[model samples]
Target: MNTSPSPSGAHHVEEGASVRLGALVPLTRPGWVEAGRHLLAGLDLAVTEVNDAGGIGGRPLELVVRDTAADPERAAAAVDDLAGLGVAAVVGEYHSVVARSAAARADALGVPYLCSSAVLDALTEQPTEWVARLAPAQSHGWRIYADFLLGAGRHRIAVVTQPSVYWASGTRILRDHLAARGGTVVELDANELTPEALCDALVDHGATALLLLVGQPEPAVPIVRAVRSDRRLAELLVGAPAGQPEFAEWAAVLGADGAGIPFLRYLPEHLGPLGERVGKELRARLGEAPSFVAFEGWDAVTVLADVLRSHGTDRAAIAGAWPDVAVEGTRGTIRFSRTPGIGVRQWAWPPVQVVDRDPTDADRFRILRTG
Candidate 1:
């Protein structure tokens, strides 16, 4: 294996005679580094497995790793750096903002990018033949949440949304989906009100369920605490679609207060055979259970390897072969769909589940529903 550092501070790891692939992740970002580490672990495992299996056309696959630091400009620059490195395809990113910028850059360079975990609805909106996602769009996941709420007979829903494009699009979809099911929605901005005031408003509106669309954990944690503390709102169903990614940390912060709060997740420990194997491998490696982001990283590499094996390492060939590519991934059978309004070249059936925060054990949240 040959390893070198580039001017952009990205590391290139080449093993044997190989087809180089690019991995863009936030390895050193303050808030995102741990997630990036787990993501890299899963990607590395997939690459190792592929190489052990004779790789694509007898050439081992190499990974050129880049740290985006969750910054948009840095992420875009990493794509350019990867293009200069002559990588066959690019995978692995967590933040949606960074993925959006990187997607544009990858498209311009004509390199196939299989997005691992970024869920912004607009990432696939731009006309790009070079980019596809392994994760579902945010709207797709929110729809699952909506179905969960409606099925549970929680009709009077209050939405607490952050001022982000990703949250806005998801909120819009949630609102429409709820309304279609004959449910009422009252929207509130998380940034505009204090947590206390937000709790008061939900109670005043008689909202049976609070749908939090905040994309980050900082605000969602406070809101959850405030809602849980209030006697009047104690019975309200608190749901945060974005909080799934940070559930372990924030749930620990909330302790017993976080119990019964529902959130959407792509993978849980109780998933079937494939999920069990992946989770066990990750646990043995990381000394803890893996997050969905890790599963996404593994699947991203898995899909990319499948594409390269059949289509060769040509960028245009990989791009052309993406639509027909189907692989049984860690989450489910991965397939791309160009459904209008959802985004083009996006995963069609991203499996999502609603899991409640366990009061006693942070790692043992029970799955309520799967969709």
Candidate 2:
């Protein structure tokens, strides 16, 4: 029996007999550690419930977690390590850069990968049969935001995008969708200037709204504060297509400045019966409501467990079963799309909401739009 120590720093008692699953998460990174904690909570809950139900094929399921630390190289190495350890499948990742790196490794190793929350369009663009994504691609989310902006009469929009491959790709989609709808877009690189300068540019261009494509909270928090503090851009509607899962945590730092700032979130306040039960369990464990990332992690494990139960623990069997695996998750029906133009093996229907930060309560953000 293999006696290697798991990433959680514990030895698996049923080492060789158990079905091992790799969980890649950012555990120690400054911006992503909190998200990782929440996601891990959901994964733990799912694993417990699955094990309680007699596991898959009467074999216990074990999670071998590896910290990505939000770094691409570290993520790639983690995938290689998981593959070397003979994990049946791998899941749980948040950063798009890390997901891209880990996906490449999973494809190279022929290990089935279920991406949890990474949203870059290019991550699923390639024809990799072993890789499938749970979250909707950035292109899909951007289109929804574009439609909302146009419908809300925000014809003149300014976009501030961070210098990341994920944000850059989303910006292209956002630009195309806005142009197709006859909306004017002024694009600015968030890395090119300070947040104060970016706000000045928005004011000069007479922008009706500002769309932020930064995927993390560190940069987003400061930008929102800068825009809200500036009198010239005080009325400008600022929104982010990413980082909604960390809205409450980041909003706590921004205080009043974060109020009314809109963001795209996947988890709504009202979950269905099953989801409500999961939420209560998570709250009891984590002392707060489960975030969207947490739900994504839980759903990833749930889908993987279902595949394992139906198709044994073989990698090829799991990959083959993914195309037909249809399960109801927290966000609604979970199914992958092979449809052209969006992305291959990507989730098409992820319930997303444009929520505004509540002025009084940082924990309870108000939903502005849902789709």
Give the lDDT of residue 174 in candidate 2. 73
Model 2, position 231, has a per-residue lDDT of: 90
Q: Return the lDDT, model 2, position 158.
A: 89
| Backbone clashes (count) for model 1 | 0
* Model number with the top TM-score: 2
lDDT of 2 by residue, 142-213 (tens): 788888888878888888886778777877887799898888888888788699899889988999898877
lDDT of 2: 0.79
Measured with C-alpha atoms, the lDDT of residue 248 in candidate 2 is 50
Score every model by TM-score.
0.88, 0.91
